[model samples]
Target: MILSIGCSEPLTTREKGAVYGTLGGAGLGAIIGSATGNAGAGAGIGAAVGLLGGALIGDQMQQRQNQDAAVQRQLSTQQAEIERQQRELEQLRRQQAR
Candidate 1:
């Protein structure tokens, strides 16, 4: 019996962070606002602030990850080229030795 599993893409770190931040902020705000007799207003304000902060942090992290990946790819390509050149040099040396 063979089984195939399909996987769906997960949310990016930025999206996840933003969602968490918004929820957390709203909850906190509501609690604080309730103490002041205005829970709804507190939650709204908290959610907005949380969402903005979370999104910014997430975006920065994502950008950094992308840059790191790019650098890794470049390093890998350079290594491959170096290997190829070494092989070619060895081949040339062998020919000259003969």
Candidate 2:
């Protein structure tokens, strides 16, 4: 009853941040440049700077997210191991009681 499309993977926050930042920076840069009487140059410079800064920030954000995910996975593994040990201990205790 339902249809699926290609590449269901969504864009990460880092990518979104980069795109937004680039657009915002360029727009702001052009406006400021226009006041000095050079819209074309202003826009070009603005867009370039914006793109670079945006990409850098996005990359950093993605890295941080990856680190956080790794930590979470580790914690989950530890917790599971602890639970397993606890269960084993409980079984041993029961056998000793009998």
Q: What TM-score do all the candidates reach, one by one?
A: 0.79, 0.83
- Tens-place lDDT per residue, model 2, 46-94, is 8788878887888898999999999999999999999999999999999
Question: Local distance difference test, per candidate?
Answer: 0.86, 0.79
Q: Stretches of candidate 2 above 4 Å error?
A: 1-8
| Alpha-carbon lDDT of model 1 | 0.86
How many clashing residue pairs appear in each of the predictions shown?
Answer: 0, 0
Model 2 pairs whose backbones collide: none
Which stretches in model 1 have alpha-carbon errors above 4 Å? 1-8
